[model samples]
Target: MIQHIRISRQLIFVNKILFVFSLFGLIGAPHTHNIRAKRYFFPLFIAIDGSFTEVKVNEWKGAASNNRNQEEDGSAFIVEILKNLGADLVDSVEYGDDELTQILLSEIKDVWRRIVNNPKSLVNSGETPESLGIYMAKILFIAKDRHCESPDETFINGKCFPISTRERSEHCPENMGLYDDEKNEGFCECLELTKEKAKSELRPIYSNETGVCYRQNTQGPCENGEWFVLKNTYPRCEPVPDGCPTDGRHVFWNPDNSTAKQCWEIWTRGPCDKGQLLHLEQDSTEEPQVYCSYRLAESFFTYSALSFPPCPPGTLSNYVGQCIGCSRGCYGAFIG
Candidate 1:
């Protein structure tokens, strides 16, 4: 019995040793594989301020400490080398802090050496003492943070503006006025006839109501309103629709003819005076349906000035003041 007990204890000790070795093997395999893979996996480009720039990691050898001139200090030498390699360091002082600058200055020599040897490894491993790869990443993050986060926004004159504003400014000439956002349809427009301009040159007349330019005696692009006519010696959209009353009323026009028009009160008994109120359907494919029904709290109502409700979550208002749904698959939000 004593011999058997001793043999059992020896077997237990051997099992524990085997378990430890197995655990270590499982953990070290991936680490060994990563080290081997990193040798030839350096990034060819770096992203900065929403743009990609080509980077040559092999050229980092020239920035090593041994290559510095005797007259130049470490920081100065590294800065000069980076400038020679096409680094945009002019805005570095504006973006970088003192702590980061001091940290880079103190350990730049070691960091550059690590980068020169294996840039991919230093970047992937998140090395201490802040490798050059890490510094560049931080710089890139700072630069991106300073600009706008929305895709619909554009950086202009050190400020963020809506993309529609930029598009209008760029596409529209000085003689032509900006097209109405709701009816722009990705096209520039001529100036409105109401605005006074030099009469030496004949230009196309723009209509604010129809959002179209009309030539002399031409029909223009009117689909619901009156045809184009020469009014006051200029081709213009005639018989403009009258404005609706401010007390929850909207313009009701005949879709078939458009000449017969009137202002109708919303959410009230009108043509159907039997105790039903007018209701307009939302997201209708056919003509806007205005039917008589009992008013409900869930029904949508609009004022004469056309006040829009707040946009739902994950959606934003566009240049035309219409709520647009955000894309689900993309990383950022954009207005269409």
Candidate 2:
């Protein structure tokens, strides 16, 4: 009888404990719960191209440059952007060995992991997902963010937006909305430049959906009363205008690098009227000319935070910003 009573008491106690645990889990256990640390693994390519083999990197930037701290600032800026855009920005930064290369690699890895990798991998499979191996098969060096200034400082070419006005954590004014950051002045200035450039010409090159044609140069007078000319192409317009068949590429692109003979396509045909984007392809590789792939036509450099696509040689496209050729082709992932 005593044994039976003891067993009953013990079972009751066990049931009570289990019930309490269930309640805690439902109500207040989160306050006491410990979160498991997320492990991030850089791809072999990023690991090898970057100066580190680990997920973390250190910048011995105690006195390297004024913008040394800005690297972290940039990372933090990115973190906020990613989070606001609903990303899994749960990892804290880790440093391997304090160096510029390490900082660049680490910061870039931090950003890329969030942007490129799916959150399901980090959540369900942890760091060693099979899909990761596909991308990490080998480390390839891409100069996506490797453009560094001389041995003195950091130079971020395409970052000219105004700084943040808010004091939120990791939030910078630069990433804040355009209307909020007092960037309207700069945007207004850009508009003025465009207006002046467009007003100088009586008839500029007009790119139809299919190909680039010109505003028709009337032989004598237009049947329509409007001042606009009918559309013309390479042979038809070449003799009429001083440089009629204007290097079709040069019509849209005003290349600043001089070496860039590519066209940057601008957006047009709307209230938006994005002019054109400049695309260039300068293959400096030793590979035979006959074996280049089609992906080579998508290299792009940022003239601003907005992206510009690049094109390979013999490919034609409109110019958007200052045009230039790169030593190699850029890899672009179109979000099809």
Candidate 3:
């Protein structure tokens, strides 16, 4: 009887060990998800000031589309490195089915106004809707912050520093490095505007005033509702990078960062959009310039892929073009 009891005890011990080891193998093993999502949102500034004045995009806003299909842009050569980074989680592999890039229309509208009145003010490398709004708040910070009695100089990064003539160097054009620095990630210093500080206007009423339109018909864009306004800042527009295609036959993709090239095609049926505005030439020597809207954010985007470029912190794993961000509410929650 004692011997039988000993055998039973040994069996229980072995079984418990085996069960725990199995749990580790199953729970700790890497899981893979195939995702579909968008990576970019086109900023469209609409004047809520109430007037017959329709925000017109003189460049490609209302232009006819023979080449650029608004909805058909599911796959092209365009890509997003950050969206591709979502799959790099511990014990996880993200597939095209697991890839996604999303933006909230509400959030997009909330910050869209900032770029409207200040054409030069744009969402550069990492500007999201919330980030832009946060920056805007700083601009209007004094109006809200009773303790603070001045207009603050906010950096593209959201750092707020005192506004001073000597501090003029703090402006990005004066210091281009600050534009790309992660450390400058907040509003700049403040300036003592008067008790009645005016917010940036919605749209410049006159050409001589301070407003310009913002247009984007290029590679890597997926969302629309492009906006415009009268900007007060000098140079009043984001300078298109010289590398921007002045000439080429390039494809685009979906905003979701979907990379299925088969989904994109060059239609010979009619005229394309970009060419109509940029006055593109098709001479073999003149290289065809094309701004692809959607494609794999990464060259090897999920065709036996490993990981995506990192999404901003607090993003969700969802459909292509579908994601959640902490700053922009990528998954849709305002943490602060």
Candidate 4:
């Protein structure tokens, strides 16, 4: 009986030790790369207002009949990862499987041609063509963040600042209001004026005031409105879509930024209820310019007037773009 009891105790002790070792083995083992076997693309953009927008791109593996469901699922998985990485809004842009194969191949051939012609472009020392290809493949799989001459402090390590604070920069443009919160305290944002203020204080009229329309009780977008008065401080209208002959593009001073930056005239698509206006091209060399270049609070966006519903504090938008109460709770809330 004593021997049996001792045997049972020894077995129990051994089992405990085995269990601990197994647990450690599982924890310290290298993670399998099943999901990573597929290629993917992710582009993260930081808006001037300090909002983080991530574009989750689907994988393109040079197979014509690639799976749509797989692409979508991978994109969704990436968006979830981005949200966990402090993304404010996540959107997906997908292409058909193998859709970009031709384009990429053409670009690669072009690069190769350039290298063959100018051998100096391909450093002969320590860098082989295969090594260059590897680096290029890495770029396609995981792109590096784009650098700017001046980056806002709110952006760090491909994520927006987590903390929220209220501080204003003395450098805000004239007539533009300054708003700052903890997460974006380091960004510079001009205040949006209310319609009432636009009408009363900074009364604006079209460049051709011959028949300028006016509404006594009309309001300007204090926040979340589509149209913003070009110049907030000294409100005045310059000949735009209707006023200009639409023959040629011209440059004018923007009213929002107190700085001296000349804004160029841009044409808009027929999305305008009126009609699409034409403009003279300044340079065909620059990327094909389009109309409706309205100034955004940030220099990053030009003439985007889309608006979504403003959700209350402590809530976030659902996958369907509807505002819902946050499950994890909101740390701070402000209109961007």
Best by TM-score: 1
> Could you tell me the TM-score of candidate 2?
0.19
How much is the lDDT of residue 209 in candidate 4?
Answer: 25
* CA lDDT, candidate 2, residue 160: 32
Better of 3 and 4 by lDDT: 4
After superposing all C-alphas onto the true structure, candidate 3 shows an RMSD in angstroms of: 27.0
TM-score of each: 0.25, 0.19, 0.15, 0.18
Model 3: which ten-residue window has the lowest total lDDT? 197-206
Q: Each prediction's Cα lDDT score?
A: 0.34, 0.25, 0.23, 0.27
TM-score-based ranking, best first?
A: 1, 2, 4, 3
Q: Count the backbone clashes (under 3 Å) in each candidate.
A: 0, 40, 81, 18
lDDT assessment of candidate 3: 0.23
lDDT, model 4: 0.27
- Candidate 2: Cα lDDT at 15: 28
Task: Show model 2 residue runs off by greater than 4 Å.
Answer: 1-97, 100-104, 110-237, 241-336
lDDT of 3 by residue, 51-121 (tens): 11223212222221321232134321011111111112111111111111112222222233323333333
What candidate 1 gets wrong by more than 4 Å, as runs, is 1-146, 149-158, 161-263, 273-275, 284-286, 300-336
Candidate 2 weakest lDDT stretch, 10 residues? 183-192
Give the per-residue lDDT digits (tens) of candidate 2, residues 1-336.
865554343333322222222222322235433121112222322433443322321121222233224333432332332222221111111111123223233433443354343333233223333333222211111212222211111122343333221211122121111111111111100000122222222222222222222232332122332222322222122233333232222222233445533322222221112442222322211110111113223332222312333221212222321111121112222110
lDDT of 3 at 320: 22
